[model samples]
Target: MRIVIFSDIHGNAVALEAVLAHIRHETAPDLIIVAGDLVADGPRPAESLAILRALPNTRFVIGNTDYDVVHERDIEYDFTRAQLSAEDLQWLDDLPFAQTVAAAPGRELLVVHANPCDLRAAIKPDHSPAIIRPLLDGVSQEIVAFGHYHVPFVRTVDRYTLVDVASVGFPRDGLLRAVYVTLTFDGANWQIAHHRIAFDAEAVARDYAAVGYPNAERKARKLLEARYRHP
Candidate 1:
């Protein structure tokens, strides 16, 4: 079985579209898991949500920003919040903190936005096994997938396999292109593939302007523009 997992789509519809196109033409995954932050930093929150909503065999888990938006706890999300409908907010609210599915007959796959105990807690790529050990305290799956730090990595700790799917929008790992992870069950164990798909970042930057964030000084506008330029 093949599975595609992505996360941290902080509302850049252009990036999400490019990744989705790759999934359609290349990966053709049997399952799609979106580990969260579906909307937060960039423009086109509603549009981004719509794209995932239209996909098949997809599951969503809530990230820190998504939790903030759904719970109305963050002021930074106000602009994107205004663009969403009540139904959209409800959908975000209903998303699970973690999802576990059967990958093979005996093996299981666990998906979470970040750490198992905390939605905002992040297990970064640079972290040592000692730092990563505590993060796996309550984790019960053999294969675990998570996202939050916006960086992609795969590591094995004793009996557990950990994967970070990285960011579909607003990547911070020194690459401008969107990043995600794909997993394939090879009968014995799972193999991981890290994907970086290029999109029309200029168009996404323009979208930020069209969505009422024309000022370069605004944090949201600056983030959207820098997403294409920076790591």
Candidate 2:
């Protein structure tokens, strides 16, 4: 079985399109998981949601930003809400926090926006085993996949193989490319592959300006630099 997972698509349809195209051209995945943070930042929130919803064999888990958008808690929630329809907001509200699926006959895979404990809680790549283990208290799955920090990484903590699929829109790892993860399970074990695809950062910048996106300057700078910047 093969699975592709991506997250942190905080709008930016251009980046999402590039990542989706890469997934289509490169692999025939049995399942596709959109881990969360669908649309809360950047531009084209509705378009980004539509693209993911139209894909086949896809599962969704709500991210912290998704939750914030639904609850009107995000700083830019009003801007994002203005771009989406009532139905779109409802769809975001209905997304589950986590998904556990059978990767193979006897193997299970856990997918979440962040850690299983909380959508806002992050499990960073630099964290040690002791720091990571407690965050996964009740998780029994062999593989735990998530994306929240916008930084991609794969780490093993105790019995769990933790995979951060990374960000498609707002990547903060200093790599100016859309990122996603592919998992291939051969009954016995799961092999992980990370794919980064280049996209037009200038187009994204134009999108923010074109749409009058909130904090357009900061967002464009972050996207171009591929790292977080203070406003």
Candidate 3:
């Protein structure tokens, strides 16, 4: 079975739409797995959720913002403080934390917004074992497909392979264009494929300005200008 894994789509319809368009044109997969962070931080939270609801054979998981909105019941979030409209706030409050155990016949994959270890926290690929070991428990198998940290790469531990599928909203600058992953599991063999799509970053910036998504333009600029936080 061919399963597509993606996440960290923080309401940037421009980016997300581009990714989806590419997916439709380039590949036809059996299922799509959304890691999480379904809304907030961008202009079109409600629109994003609506599109997600429309996807066929797709699984949507919860991100930190999804959990926060569900628990806090606030009209606006800190990331989009004074930016997101009231309707957008409502959209944020409505997403679910998704998981697919016993996934795709024989292969089991954990789908989480950020990390199985800490949903509310931001974790990187090269993290210490001590920090990430606890996050792997309770799940049937590791082979996790996740997002939340915008950068993409694979981290393989002794017992698991954590795949950070990256973010369409926040692409890693100076790298291959932002993308998700295609994992095919035929009984026991697992094959991975990375997919990339092109979007208008300038158009996205313009939308950010028009929607009043807090300091979206500035934050988005920061994400695009910098290579990585540590660098």
Candidate 4:
């Protein structure tokens, strides 16, 4: 079975659309796994949720931001930012917190928004393996996927594969890009690939501008522009 994993849409429907198009042309996987953070932050959270609901075969688990926006205002979770619309929050509130499945015999997968061991478990990119390994013990899956750091990368330890696909809207790499995972089962082994690529920046930026998030729009554009130059 082949499954695609993605996270942190953060209301950027254009990025989500571009990534969906890429996935259709590429893996054509049987299932799409959403790691969470479906709305808020960018623009048009409601439209983003609509698009997510449109996917034919999608499974999901809420992200930390999703929880923050859903469960309560939680002034600590980027409270300075504007509050999401009642509809957006309601959609997020309706989502599940964590999802678990057995992709194949002896091969299991866990999806979450933040560290599986603890929602508050924070790890820097350069943290030691010892420090990182414990944060992973909380989930009992052969493969554990998560987001929230907004940094894209992967790590493998013991019998577990840690995939941090990053944020499609607020990437640390500085680009309007989407990160995804492709899981292919070959005999007894699981091949997990993390995919990241740029999408339509101007369209999403226009949405942000229209939504009155000029500050966020400017910051997002700068990230994308820097990536364009560097890449």
Candidate 5:
């Protein structure tokens, strides 16, 4: 079975369009998973949500930003939340915290936006075994797929496989491209591949000015011009 997993769209519809086109043209998969952070912090919240909503057979999870959209009492989120319809908010509110996908008969893949315990917890590529082991508590699946760090990585800890599918819109790897991961399970073993598709970063950055919020353009420009924070 072939499964494509992506996360952290963060409201950039342009980038999401490129990624969706690539998926349609390049391959057909059995399942699609959106780990989380589908909106907020970018230019096109409604458009982004529309694109994802149209996809078929896709599973979704709630991320930290997604949770904040519903519960946080902050003014910064108003514009993005306003663009969403009542149905959209309900969908976001109902998203699962985690899901287990059985790619093959006996091959199980656990999907979560971040750590199994907390949506805010991030598992960086360089974390020590001591730091990583606790995150696996109560997780029995041999393969664990997660996102939120916005950096793609495949790591082995004990007998478990950890995969971070990475971000689609606001990538912190400094490439300014959309990224996701595919996992192919062949009964016993799982194969992984990382895909990075390019989109118009400059145009999308300019879109922030018209996002209808205070200093939206400035905030967007700061994100676009900033250096990558993670290795």
Candidate 6:
């Protein structure tokens, strides 16, 4: 089975489009998993959600930003909610925290926005096993995949192979390219591949001003820099 998973598309439809194009050109997987944060920080919130909704055979897991938008918990929530309709919000709210897929008869793959314990808890690449083990407390899957940190990484901890599929939009890994992961499972083992697609960073950055997105300057600057910045 071949599966593609991507997350942290913080409202940049342009970047998502580029990633989707890459997914179609290469790694035509059997299933696509959208590990969340669909919209809430950049421009084109509604459009981003619509694009992902149109995908076939895809599973979704809600992320911290999605949770905030649904519950109206953060400053960005109001702005994101203003751009979305009732149905869009309902779809975000209805997303599960985690999804499990059967890779083989006894092998399984787990997908989540972040760690299983908390959507806000990021599983960074540098974290030790002790820091990651508790996050996988009740997880029984041999392979676990997630996205939240926006940095791609694959780590093995005790019995679990943790895969951070990275961000499709708003990547903070010192690169402007949109990234995701593809998993190919043979009868017994899983092979992982990370794909990074270059999109028009300038166009996406300019979209903030074009759409009059809130905190446009800071967000645009962050996108160009490909790193997080304090607002």
lDDT of each: 0.83, 0.88, 0.71, 0.71, 0.86, 0.89
Question: Which residue pairs show backbone clashes in model 1?
Answer: 174-231
Would you estimate the TM-scores of all the predictions? 0.91, 0.96, 0.83, 0.83, 0.95, 0.96
Judged by TM-score, which candidate is best?
6
By lDDT, is 2 or 6 better?
6
Error of 3 at 42 (Å): 1.3
Q: After superposition, how far is residue 121 of candidate 6 from its true place, in Å?
A: 0.8
lDDT of 2 by residue, 114-179 (tens): 898888778887877888888899887889999988888998888889999999998888888899
Scored against the true structure, residue 219 in model 2 reaches a CA lDDT of 75
Name the runs in model 2 displaced over 4 angstroms. Answer: 73-75, 229-231
Higher-scoring candidate on lDDT, 1 or 2: 2
Model 3 shows how many backbone clashes?
Answer: 4
By lDDT, the candidates rank as 6, 2, 5, 1, 4, 3
lDDT digits (tens) for residues 63-87 of candidate 3: 8867665555453565443444565
Model 4 vs. true fold: TM: 0.83
lDDT of 6 by residue, 78-179 (tens): 888989999999999999998999987879999998888888888888888989888999888999999988889998999899999988898888988899
lDDT for residue 195 in candidate 4, whole number 0-100: 81
Inter-residue clash pairs, candidate 6: none
Worst 10 residues of 5 by lDDT: 222-231
Per-residue lDDT value at 21 in model 6: 90
- The lDDT leader among the candidates is 6
Candidate 4 segments whose C-alpha is farther than 4 A from its true place: 71-88, 214-218, 221-231
Report clash pairs, candidate 4: 174-223
Q: Tally clashes: model 4.
A: 1
TM match of model 6 to true structure: 0.96
- Give the per-residue lDDT of model 4 (tens digit) for 1-231: 887888888777788887888898988998888888777566766667778878998987777667766665543234313445666566666778678768677688887777776554545456678888877765678887787777777777776777776777666666446777787877687887878777777777676667665476564675466342211
Candidate 3, poorest ten consecutive residues by summed lDDT:
222-231
Better of 3 and 4 by lDDT: 4
